[model samples]
Target chain A: MSTPVLELARVTVEFPTDRGRLRPVDGVSFSVEAGKTLAVVGESGCGKSVTALAIMGLLPQGGEVGGGIRLAGEELLALTPDQRRARRGGEMAMVFQEPMTSLNPAFTAGEQVAEALRLHQGLSPDAAFAKAIEMFRRVRIPEPERRARSYPHQLSGGMRQRVMIAMALACRPRLLIADEPTTALDVTVQAQILALIDEMKRETGTAVVLITHDLGVVRDHADEVVVMYAGRIAERAKAADLFANPQHPYTIGLLGAVPRLEGGAARLASIEGTVPDLMNPPPGCRFAPRCPFAIAQCAEQPPLAEVTPGHQAACWRAPLDTLLEQAA
Target chain B: MSAPLLELRDVAKGFPVRDALGRRRGAVRAVDGVSLIVPKGSVLAIVGESGCGKSTLGRLALRLIEADQGQILFEGEDLRGLSARALRARRRDMQLIFQDPFASLDPRMTVEQAVAEPLRLHGIVPRAQEAQRVAELLSRVGLRPELARRWPHEFSGGQRQRIAIARALASEPKLIIGDEPVSALDVSVQAQVVNLLQDLIRELGLTFVLISHDLGVVRHIADRVAVMYLGRIVEEGPTAQVFGAPRHPYTRALLAAVPGQGHAHAPLLEGDIPSPINPPSGCRFRTRCPYAQPLCAEQVPPMEGTSHLAACHFQQNLPPALVGQDAETGGERLRRLQAYFTDQTQKQGELA
Candidate 1:
């Protein structure tokens, strides 16, 4: 079998606080092949963003990372800071949630994208600027030549995101990590930006790690999904199988929580209680406290095990059908 | 039907735009000549993207911001004509819930104090019974009474929003306007809040005006929906009718833009929402409307239809909304999986 474009093996990220350590991302493992999209789904503080940051070697100050992050069989943690920086824009690129914040307000949109090209590909100043305009055109920004001169604040939210995408893909990196790329924009503009990313992925065969809290976006865009709860992987499977036969209790509760546009029950199914604080996580399964099907055996953490052929869940009573049948 | 609990007739509001040097450039017409009626004990959701005036309309309805033009009638009385003192008295009947719970709440105040402030202001309860009243209010929104002593900063996002809701309900309001109340919450917590709001609306027979951009939430909670673009409402109708058979091209495009509604490749709208400072000549949506014709630019289209209305010249001849197959979400198995969730909740209820 061909090697995957990117693979994470039991990644852990911790930050030392005055009150002991806080592990935001704990033992997360997943992979994405060339041209496939892997969606990391979670709520606020679930460490989905931290995982992305860890992979990019962009963790905030005081953060300590452990475990393997491989890009095309190249071990990333073993690389020096300068070597990592060299490979960042050339081999892997990340697009942030808010373009207004991520982009430099002082630079014109065109210059911002062109700077990446010159730094990564060693293109001439004039050639890089010309290619930046071409990249803008490829992303379907209208009147690319004129619009390129506009600063970040001068462009609309959708247009600013287009510029960000153009910059991220200008290097044609093997891996693209977009952290909630469209959450700040309106839904209509979100559609346009998502389509642009999908199109670019197909054209470049870039492996995508899309981190979002919106299930609808995942349902439509993701090839595979990793459902995270309290910094731990709760479930992982092909998107179709995950949606159809969600094994973990958290995944089921999350799927039932989203208000379906197609219309369903009047009242949404809610999982009781808030997400557990990760500062002092539970001794056993991270989701046990909130899991309705939790048993005494759940006091010992369950390893991520196969529930079906390619589907894995970290619940003691996974293959919940058997659990339910036993209960009945 | 009886008279509407709240009504707006040709309401319009504009904010003056200023350049960096502070010179008056032009006014951004936020809400332009919008008219609607909210019947007693019903949910009317105004859905649109940012800059679409849904939030501005909600503020106008509550008199939080004054409209430059038009009449706002509350229970057959015009609010625009009310005196300052009279408006304060009327304020007890209406309340506003903002989108961000963290920003909306006061960190310094305890939950009990925040919830009881409205009661004290409105003279709903005597000073002696204020604590008891606050406790009851907290429990009504599904918060524990003991948590009342805790500060707002101590609560989670969802908990803070419940405290906000409890405060909103303290004065026993008849009409509530929630501007993207659940938008900032996580999916699971959002569901909990949505269900809580649903129960509150039903049990209290409250009239609700939900201003949100989330179509799925609107479809679940609203009896009727209004789709806005630029500064004007482009479509208004029963939620089922509008979602099932949208007439306006803009509304169709908005529905199609939902993530799971159609294939990702088939994008509907093109350019961003045009600047509200100098909107299009006639129809505000014409710039992005796929089926826009010369007539659309020539004259503004008046809203047509009795119960269901669409403000478009070609609304009648527009093609049906092409939302993709319902089976893409893995329909049958998903339903079966969700059924187990419902069963588990019921079992929990029984055990309790």
Candidate 2:
């Protein structure tokens, strides 16, 4: 098999507070194949975004990332600050959730894309600006040249997201990290943006790590799925397999919580408690407190072992079908 | 079915656009020539994207924002005819729940103070019984009565929403309009709140107006659904009919655009919703409608049908809605597993 485009080994991120060190992302590991999409799914504060920042080396002040992040077999964490900066827009790029905040209000949309191109591709301003307009056109922004000259405020949410995509893909980055790219946009616009990303992935063979809380979005777009709970990976598997047969209690709970359009008027099955506090996380399995299948053995941490071929879950009571049958 | 609890007859509202110099430029027809009927004890959901005027319509329904033109009839009485005193008195029956619980709640007030305020104002119970009533309201929304003394800032998003719901119920309102009530919470928490709302609606038999963009939530809760676009309802029907077989192109597109409904990558509609200030001349949805004809660009399509209404030039001849392939995620077993997650009794029973 061909080598994966991106791999993470024991990825851990820690932030120091006055009392103690807060480990939000702990010992996370995953791999994304070239041209395929891997979705990191979790609620807010689940370390999904933190994991992305760890990979991009963009952690905020006093936040330390410990782990090996390999992009195309090259270690990103080992690179010098300057070297990492050089590779950022050229080999790896990210599209943020809110384009309005990420984009500069002073710079025109076209100029932003052009700036990335000039910085990464070393093209002249005029040439880069022209390419920027072309990129705008490629991303299906109507009236590309005119829209390119408009500031971020002038463009709508969908249009601004398209501009962000144009900027991110301007240098043809091999790894594209989109963090809730469509959360701010309307559903119709979201569909358009996701479709554009899929097209770009197929055309450029870029490895995509889509970070989202929306399961429907993951079901449609992600090839592989990683379910995170309180900054730890609870389950990882093929998207179809995970959805069809979720092994972790958190995964099943999350799936059951969503109000499906087809599941007419059925009472939604809700998880009882809130996400655990990361700073003072519970011992053993992070989800044990909330897991219905939890037993006395759950006090001991469960390893993320293979429940099936290519499917892993961090639960002592994995393969819960047998338990159900025994109870019956 | 039942008599309408609230009705609007050709209601319209416009906010005047002003320049930096305070000179009026034009008007944004936010809710233009719209009409709706909310039956007593029924959930009427208005689903639309942002800037589509669903929020404005909800506000107009409660007279939170006055409509520029048309009659707002509440309980068969013209709300627009009421004087200031009468309106204030009538306000006890109608309440609004906003999307952002963080903003909707008073940061300085304790949960007890917030919930008790409405009871005091309405004189529902004596001052002596206000605490007891507040406790009841808190427990009604699934929050612990002991937490009433805490400030809004101390609670989580879902808890804050529960407090908000408790406050809204304090007045014993006959009609409650929830504007994206659970949109701000995580899915797990959203479901809890959704279930809470379902239980309240059933137990109280209160009329509900759910204004949301989340189709799944709307479908699950609302008996009747109204699809709005550019300040007008393009489709209105029973939830089953609208989801099963939508008549309008925009409605179909909206349904198709939902992420988990199987259709991905292929966008059913194109382009952004046009600026409402200077809307397209004829049909408001013609700009993005897939089945839009030349006639649609020339004349506005009048809403047709009695039960399942749709405003389209050729609703009868439009192609069938794209059938979504069910992304089968084991149904019966999935439910049982989910049941175990929420119900501890189920787990204990299994163990026994």
Candidate 3:
């Protein structure tokens, strides 16, 4: 197998809160192969975004990142600040959820994309501007030149997101991290943006780390799925396998909780209780408190073990059918 | 048989667009020529994207915002004709639950005081009995009565929503309009609240108007559904029929766009929704409609259906299956999920 474009090993991120250090992302491990999408799925504060930030070495002040992040077998954690900044756009780039906030309101859309090109590729201002227009056109931005000159406020949400994508892909980075890229846009617009990302990946062969809470989005787009609960991976498997045979209780609960567009009305199988507090996380499995299948053994930490080939879950009661039959 | 619990006749609402200088530039038709019926004790969901005027229509039903040209009838009485005092008294029968429970609730007030305020104002219960009624309302919505003394800030999003629901029920309203009530909650918590609402609607025999962009939630709770586009309902029908066989191109597109259905990348509609201030001349959806033609841009399509209504010129000409044949039929996944839920419940029962 080819070397993964981006890899993480035991990535743990800790933040110093007033009470104590909160480990929001703990011992996370995953790799994104070039041209394929690895969806990190979780609810808010599930460390999906924090994992992305840690990989990019963009963790906010007071956040301690411990673990290895590698870009094409090169150690990212060992790089100097300058070296990291240089590699950021050229090797990797991130598209955030809120295009409005991430983008500079003072600058025009063209200037932003051009700035990325200039800083990363060492292109002249005029050359970068031309490249920006080209990138915009490639991303299917209608009236590319005119739209490029428009400021962030002038462009609609979808168009601004396209601009963000254009900027992220301008340098042809091998890795692209999109954190809820289409969340703020409407469904129609969301469809367009997701399609655009998929197209860009196909054309560029860029590894994508799509961080989103919506399982439906993961089902449609991701090659591999990582289900996170309270900063730990609850389950990991191929997208189809995960959907067809979710092993973890949290994953099953999540699937049942989602109201399907095609499904008839039924009482949603809601997971009881909320996400555990990461500040003072419960012992053993983070999901045990909320898991209906939990037993006394669940109080002891369960290793993430393979249930089937390429399918893994972190639960003592994995392969729940067996457990259910025993109980029955 | 009986008159609809609430009805709107040719309802239209327009807000004047003003420049920075405060001069009226033009009028934006937020809700234009919308007419709907809510049968007693039925859940009617208004589904649409942002700026489609679903929220505006919800407010119009409650007469929170007056419609310029329409008649809003509550219990078969025209609300516009009612005096201010009469309207205030009539308000006791209808209540609203907003999207952001945190924002809708008073931060300084305890849950008890918040719930009792409506009872005190409406004189639903005697002053001495307000506390008991508040506790009942709280417990009815799945909150512990002991937590009624806590402020809104102390509760979680779902709990805050429960408090809001409790307050809504405090007035003993016959009808409740929830504008994206559970949209702010996590999926697990959202389901709990949805089940609660469904239970309340069934047990209390209350009518509900749920305004949400989430099709899944709407499908779960709504008996009837209305699909709104730029300020107009493009489709309205029983949930089963509309979702099973979506006739309107926009409706089909919206359903197709949903993620979990294993739909291949099929762009049903393209381009952003046009500005409401200067809407397209004919069919509002024509600009983005795939089947739109010269005729579509020239004339408006009148809604036509006996039981399942759709306002589109090419509704009949549309393919019987806009989505692929392999797409799972509505209700199959839910049935399986329901079975799963039941099995899990039994397991938990055994464990307990």
Q: Give the number of the best model, judged by DockQ.
A: 2
Worst ten in a row by lDDT for model 3 chain B: B324-333
Q: What tens digits encode model 3's per-residue C-alpha lDDT throughout A1-328? A: 9999998998899998899999999999989999999999998889999999998889999898888999999999999989999888889999999999989999999999999998988999999999999999998999999998999999989999999999999999999999999888888889889989999999999999999988888988999999998988889999988887778888878877887665544677877667888888999988887776678998888988999999999999878767546645
lDDT of 3 by residue, B1-352 (tens): 4569999999999999999899999999999999999999999999998899999999988888888999999999999888889999999999999999889999999999999999989888988888888888888988878887888998889888888998999888999999999998878788878878988999999999999988888888899999999999999999978888988888888877777666563654677889899999888898888788898889889899998999999898987744422234223433453355546654654111
lDDT of 1 by residue, A100-217 (tens): 9989999999998999999999999899999999999999999999888999999998999999999999999999999999999998899989989999999999999999998878
Model 1, TM vs. native: 0.97
Candidate 2, residues A1-66, lDDT tens digits: the string is 887889999999999998799999999999999899999999999999999999888999999988
Residue pairs with colliding backbones in model 1 are none
What C-alpha lDDT, on a 0 to 100 scale, does residue B84 get in candidate 1? 93
* Model 2 spans > 4 angstroms off: B263-267, B323-326, B345-352
Across residues B1-352, which tens digit of lDDT does each residue of candidate 2 receive? Answer: 8899999999999999998899999999999999899999999999999999999999998888899999999999999999989998999999999999999998889999999999999899999998999989998988888998999999889999999999999999999999999999999889889988998999999999999999989888999999999999899999889888889888888888889655442455798999999999788999898777899989989999999999998999987776432367867777777778657634433110
Q: What lDDT score goes with residue A254 in model 1?
A: 87
Candidate 2's TM-score reads 0.98
| DockQ list for all candidates | 0.59, 0.60, 0.54
Q: Which digits, one per residue and each the tens of the lDDT, describe model 1 over residues B21-73?
A: 99999999999999999999999999999999999999999888999999999
Interface RMSD of each: 2.6, 3.1, 4.1
Error of 2 at B155 (Å): 0.9
Screening candidate 2 with a backbone cut-off below 3 angstroms (N, C-alpha, C), the clashing residue pairs are none
